[model samples]
Target: MTRTLEWQVRVGLSEEDGTTRAEAVLDTGSEKLIGHGVARCNPQDVDVPVIGDELAASRAMKDVAAQLMKAADHELETVGAGPASGPVAPPYAWSDTTA
Candidate 1:
């Protein structure tokens, strides 16, 4: 079965200090999840700050992945019931965009 997902992202920055903020939203039609992050100063700046938008987006997707993995594992374990060992296969697999 194939699942469809919809997502959105927004980034903002502070004019004075160049602080950056990012927000991401993930929705699966039936459910929704959100992630927010911030970055301050420039990477080349003396203080050196983390890049918020990238961090936020990446982390958010990571969280979603974790959740999906856990759910898949649980389902597989339940269905197997007598799993004796060996590698637990992922319920689903996806590949990154290739050009």
Candidate 2:
């Protein structure tokens, strides 16, 4: 069986030097961390470069993952009884419902 962990990413913006810079926030329940530095302001402020968006998002995700691992590995202690060692159930199965 496979288990899914939930996570969420939030984007935020701030104005600096007449241009809006983007930032990202990651929520993993146990830990919350702000990721990536704001993209450099554009010349016109209204026009945002494509490359910046990609870079900013990528950086944020990387940072979030790093933070999560650091917290999990703290003091060699396991959290929440540690990840399941054995598969709890088959990957996929179905029960008959037709009469």
Candidate 3:
């Protein structure tokens, strides 16, 4: 069965008092999910707005990913497939190889 599905995700970022906050929202037609993240700069560290935005956005996306995984696992269980054997692994595993 060939099926086509499209999901839309929107991310917004804001900064206040040296802190950056990000909100990511995913719309899957039938449902919507939202994830939030925040990044704060240390007083001794250099101030870089772009860096904070990057960090906050990445974290928010990570939150969304985790939510999606949980939803998938629950759906599988609902279908009698049972929950995953264990925690779902991230797309990439950390490696010690020096580039």
Among all candidates shown, the one with the greatest TM-score: 3
Best-to-worst lDDT order = 3, 2, 1
Per residue, candidate 1 scores C-alpha lDDT tens digits across 1-99 of 997765543333332356655555656566555555555665576643345545545655666566656665677788987355778655467655577
Of the pair 2 and 3, which is ahead by lDDT?
Answer: 3
lDDT of 3 by residue, 45-79 (tens): 99999999999999998899889988887998889
Clashing pairs in 3: none
TM-score, model 2 to reference? 0.48
Q: What's the true lDDT of residue 60 in model 2? A: 65
Tell me the lDDT of candidate 2: 0.62
Better of 2 and 3 by TM-score: 3
Per-residue error for 20 in candidate 2, Å, reads: 7.0
lDDT of each: 0.56, 0.62, 0.90
Top candidate by lDDT: 3
Between candidates 1 and 2, which one is better according to lDDT?
2
The number of residue pairs in model 1 that clash at the backbone is: 0
